[model samples]
Target: MDRITLAFWSLVIGLCGATAFFVTGIYGQQATQQQREAKLESGDLVQLVKVIDGDTVVVSKEGQPNATVRLLGIKTLESKHGKDEVAVYGRAAEEALKRLVGDKPLRVLLNTPPRDRHGRTIATLYAGDQDIGLGLISQGHALVYSVYPFASMPVYLQAQTTARANNLGLWGDPEVSAKAEAMINEWARQGS
Candidate 1:
């Protein structure tokens, strides 16, 4: 083949390969979205074994391993830490979560990225008629944490506002306390 013709064909092949890669990427993203929706609609039922804290809960399912769920869109006080000191409102958040979902039938709505690095199921949970995460925020036991994909952002934000205005839970402190926020930031900075 002529030199020019060979170069032209090479360019065409490269373009085709690039196009294929782009199309595959787009399709993969769409498939991921669809899978997340399907999981949410499936309403996976689980039995709450215990409330680890306001934002974390342990649940048991038949034929499946026990999973730790991190309540989506919310950050509650550090109630049960292995090394760190318990932050303000930590005990209250723990008690509130226990009252909401401990030893109850709960439904887990998995997020797009299901399990977090800590092996906790990142999901929006429903216990009976209450949205567990929203309940904690609305009652002033937790704060809206928007770092990840949360089920209902607007509702959770409103709940946080109400809680703050009412001076409930962590909001009651005399001044803005950076304890929990600092701890979370440090954890993230350390890539933990």
Candidate 2:
């Protein structure tokens, strides 16, 4: 072949190889991401990265990026930017979650559609067989988030009722009780 023809063929082959490599890399990355999501959906245990609050956490598996998880079926008070009593209870709630999840692998039970409006994974975390959300509600460190229906809504509502009636954790303190009660009432109204 002449020099021009040979050079044209060489360049075409190189371009084709480059395109193939690019497409392969893209697909490989997508496969890896899908595998990570599937693992979460399968309720695999992941390491706890951080306890963001009572209702939120950061978690990850060996090869996946950290996922921000919103604990389903419950909500905790704001640990920041709230009234004094609320903030106090919020901080306590955060600590309670830390203790509950300390050094244990969390089993992630993802909700249907998996993510929420804020792009956080909506899941119920379990430390072994113990449901963390139920523990928090039962202890009065969190409240049942009844606006959205979940599998454990009835159990969580009952736990919250018992916690409130017995004056546990945040419910026990008069200063926090009034404020917490108001919030609970609001949630009840919204749910109704």
Candidate 3:
């Protein structure tokens, strides 16, 4: 075969390989989305395995596999999210959450889409009707995370207000609390 023909065929093969890779990636994303939706629809109660951070936890329920649950309507200081940024009261917030919600099967309440962009459950957790997010906010470990659409925004905001009023947990640390308040304000603005 001519060199020119050989080169053309090689280029065609490369294009085909690239297209296949792109197509596969798209399907993988779709399958992930479908899996998340199915999990949310299941409504299986999950036992808390451990806390990943202040606002995230690992849980497992019957029938379904273990999954990471991101606590809704609250954003706590980042404790272990790499070296880019770290907050002062991050560990304290995690410890407080562990204490507040010991060992229990948290009923996952799907408020909106089953998962966030990162593929984690975006839902409210309840320990026998008690909202977990409210408990965390009341202790001042987390601020009302109103940057996104959520049903518990008003209640979470109220809990945060009460925490601030009495100077509970992180609220006692003025510097940290001030930074958190600034973040909360920004989240509220974006949400609006």
Candidate 4:
């Protein structure tokens, strides 16, 4: 190759590497800084504050108040923002999550290693023996995240199959059935 051509290719490769580092903080890897945060120590008990949506929650542990927790292994429909109307099945999904975690008094715990780019704790939540994200998927309120494997993957996949077979929640609603997974893939594709 000519010297000029080689130099140009080198510059382009360097620029792409630099951009990926600053943008996603890792090359060809998806977990953000937040998701890369230190894993919660085993046996730490964190209390649920409230459900943020179908898959996120506000929680606290001892001194840390209102820590954001993202449910591992699943993603739900986007909830309404500001004065905007609820996305199709959004409210129902959120409500379903709330019912699953209602006043029976529940606590959240993380079996995952890190948080998301938003600095939200990535976690697996259970109310007694029930897995929260799996419950959402089974009810058709959520889907397997697919970005990374979680501890309960097989069961979550089974739940998703059952939910799909039954046409529950988002899967059941033709209005969003096509767009829902696309939005999720787009969001992940953009790494936001």
Candidate 5:
């Protein structure tokens, strides 16, 4: 074969190999994304294994390991390692979540990208028709997590406004509200 023809064929083969690599990579990424979406489909029923706090819980899906789920669009006071007033409100939040969830199976709805920086799955859990995250905000046990963008942000904010207006739960107590506000600001600062 002529040197020119041999060089042309070699170049064509290299280009074909590169194209195949890129195409495979794109398809592989799509497959991975699809798997993630399918892993926690909306309306998947899960048992509430434990309430970590007002905004977090341990849940068990059928045939899957227990997962730590952080409620989307809400932040609860620290239930551990805080002063008396903060801890008081924090525990109140936990109890409120427990009461809301009871022993019922939760309908899990995941947020885009699903996982948080801490590797916990970020989800909005529902007990029947009630959104557990919104319920906490409505009861003033949680603050609307405005730091992160989520689909329920607007509704969560509205619930929090009503809770504040009614002086329900944490908002009813001036001391707790002040402490929670300070903590939330600090959290925002850390996140930024």
Candidate 6:
């Protein structure tokens, strides 16, 4: 073949390869997004082996490494901080979670993006017949935290509001007088 003709063909082939790569990359990204969405739609049953805190649990799924699950739509008080003391309600929250799900069977219903940045599974957890997040909020052991896209935000909020009105757990502590204020201050100081 002529030198110019060979050079022209090489350029054309390179452009084609580049286009293929770009197309594949786009398709790959789309496929990954779809897979993530699908995962969010499925629920997995796991054994709750460890209670990390009020809003986090570690579950063991068969044939898979233990998954750290962060409960959706709830925030518990901080149990530990670098230098700060544990928050007032922190122990209570942890205890409540432990009472609810520790060493028990749990169903983890994933939300979009199954895992969070810290490698925790973001899920709505169920223990037996109870929704774990709602149970925590209803008991006043945790607060409803409605960040964007948390699947159970409305239910969690309702549970928390009802708990507050009924003076459940922390809310029922008359000695504190301003129960919510006290809990918030403690949470802020300890940094959950």
Residue 98, model 6: lDDT of 84
Greater lDDT among 1 and 3 belongs to 3
lDDT comparing candidate 5 with the true structure? 0.85
Candidate 4: minimum summed lDDT over ten consecutive residues — where? 28-37
Candidate 5 lDDT over 50-109, as tens digits, reads: 888889898888886677789998888888967778787889899999999999999999
Please state every model's RMSD to the true fold in angstroms: 9.9, 10.7, 4.5, 7.3, 10.0, 10.5
Please provide TM-scores, in order, for all candidate models, with all chains considered together.
0.66, 0.77, 0.76, 0.68, 0.74, 0.65
Q: What is the C-alpha lDDT profile of model 3 across 1-192, one tens digit per residue?
A: 999999999999999999999999997996775475326443567788889988998777767666778888888888876543235578878888787778866788875776877778877888777788899898888888777867777887888889999998789877777787788778768978
Best by lDDT: 2
Q: What ranges in model 6 sit over 4 Å off?
A: 1-41, 81-86, 173-192
List the candidate 3 regions with Cα displacement exceeding 4 Å.
1-38, 81-88
Q: How close is candidate 4 to the true structure, as a TM-score?
A: 0.68
Cand. 3 Cα-lDDT: 0.79
Model 6 shows how many backbone clashes?
0
Deviation (Å) of 67 in candidate 3: 1.2
Local accuracy of candidate 6 as per-residue lDDT tens digits, 62-88 = 765566678877778687654333355
Model 6 per-residue lDDT at 125: 82
What residue runs in model 2 are displaced by over 4 Å at the alpha carbon?
1-39
What C-alpha lDDT does candidate 2 achieve relative to the native structure?
Answer: 0.86
1-192: candidate 1 lDDT, tens digit per residue: 999999999999999999999999987886564444322223888887777777887776665656767888888777555534345477788888888876678887887777676545688888887899889888878877765534598788787777777877677774433564564466456543
The deviation in Å at residue 33 for candidate 4 is: 14
Residue 158 lDDT in candidate 6: 82
lDDT values of the candidates?
0.73, 0.86, 0.79, 0.72, 0.85, 0.73
